[model samples]
Target: MTTSLVRIGLATALLLGSIGAAAAHAHLKASTPAAGTTISAAPAELRLGFSEGVNLKFTGVVVTGPAGVVATSTAAMAPGDDKTLVVPVAGPLAPGAYKVEWHALATDGHKTDGSYSFTLKP
Candidate 1:
C-alpha cells in the first residue's frame, strides 16, 4: 500500500511539472499602441511585451493599414529586455484601422502568434 501511494505521488508530481511548463509559453502581455486603442497620430514603432522571453530570429510583426501591407522592419528585442519586441514602421500611417500580426518563439521553444487592431484617428 505504501509503495502504491508513493508511485501515485510521483506520477502526480510529474503531471504538475508538465502542466507548469506548458503554461510558460510566451503570451502577449501588452503593447505600445495597445490593443484596440485609437491614436491621434501615427506611431513610429510597434512595441509588444510578452509573458516570456522571445527569440527575435523566429519572431516578426506584419502591419496592414488602409492601403494594405504597411512596410515594417524586422522585429528586434529591446536593448536589455528579451520580453519586448520592437518593430519599426517604415512610414507614416494613414488614418484608418491598422492590424498588427505578430509571431513569437519563446525561449523555451514554444511558438505563439496573435494579432490586434488599432484605429488611427484622422
Candidate 2:
C-alpha cells in the first residue's frame, strides 16, 4: 500500500512540473540603456532581454518622452537569440525622462507586458 501511494505521488509531481513549465511566460530580464539609469548619450538601439524565447512577430516596444512619442524602427530579435528584442531609435533623443512600454508573447503562446523608465542627461 505504501509503495503504491509513493508511485502515485511521484506521478502527480511529474504532471504538475510539466504543467508549470508549459505555462511559463516571457518576463523582462534585463535591458540596455537599462531601467532607471541616466545616460549622457542616447543609444542608437534599445535591447531588451527576456526570461524565455519570445515571438518577434508578437513583440513590440513603444517609447515616450517629454516631447511625446518617439519614433522607432521595427523591432527584431537579436541574431541567434530569440529572447532579446532590439529596437532602433529613429533619431537622437532630447535630454529628459523616457518610458518604454513593451509587450511580448512567449513561444509557448503566453503573453506578458510591462514598462520601465530611464533618463537622458545633458
Candidate 3:
C-alpha cells in the first residue's frame, strides 16, 4: 500500500513539473526594419532581436529573393549575451520587396516564427 502511494505521488509531481516547464514564456520581442520597412538599398546583413535567449543551432533565415530562395553558407548564430543575431544575407537582392521568413527555438524549446519584407530600391 505504501509503495503504491509513493508511486502515485512521484507521478503526480512529474506531470506537474512537465506542465509548468512546457508553459514557459518565450517569444520574439522585436526586429530591425520593423517587419515591413523599405530600404533604399539592399542591406549587407539581416539582424533580429528576440525577447529571450534562443538556441542558434536550430534557427535559420529563409530569404525569398527576387526569383526564389537565395542560397546561404553560414548557419544562424545562437544567442549570446545579446538576444540579437546578425544573419548573413544570402546574396544581393533585386529591386523589390524581399520576404524573410525566420524561425527560432528559444532556450525553453518554444519555437517562434515571423516574416518581414524590405524593398531593394527599384
> In candidate 1, residue 88 scores what lDDT?
90
Question: Which number leads on TM-score?
Answer: 1
| Of candidates 3 and 1, the better by lDDT | 1
Total clashes for model 3: 1
List candidate 1 segments past 4 Å from native.
Answer: 1-17
lDDT winner: 2
Per-residue alpha-carbon lDDT of candidate 1 for residues 1-122, written as tens digits (9 for 90 to 100): 69999999999999987986788899999998999999998999999999999999998888898999998877689999999999998887889999989899999788999999999999
Error of 3 at 102 (Å): 1.1
- lDDT of all predictions: 0.91, 0.94, 0.72
For candidate 3, lDDT tens digit of each residue in 1-122? 69999999999999987985666534556665557677786676777777777677877688886778866557654445446766776667677767878888778777878887766777
Could you tell me which 10 consecutive residues in candidate 1 have the lowest summed lDDT? 16-25
lDDT at 47, model 1: 94
Cα TM-score of candidate 2:
0.83
RMSD values, in order shown = 3.4, 4.5, 3.3
Q: What is the lDDT of candidate 1?
A: 0.91
TM-score head-to-head 1 vs 3, winner: 1
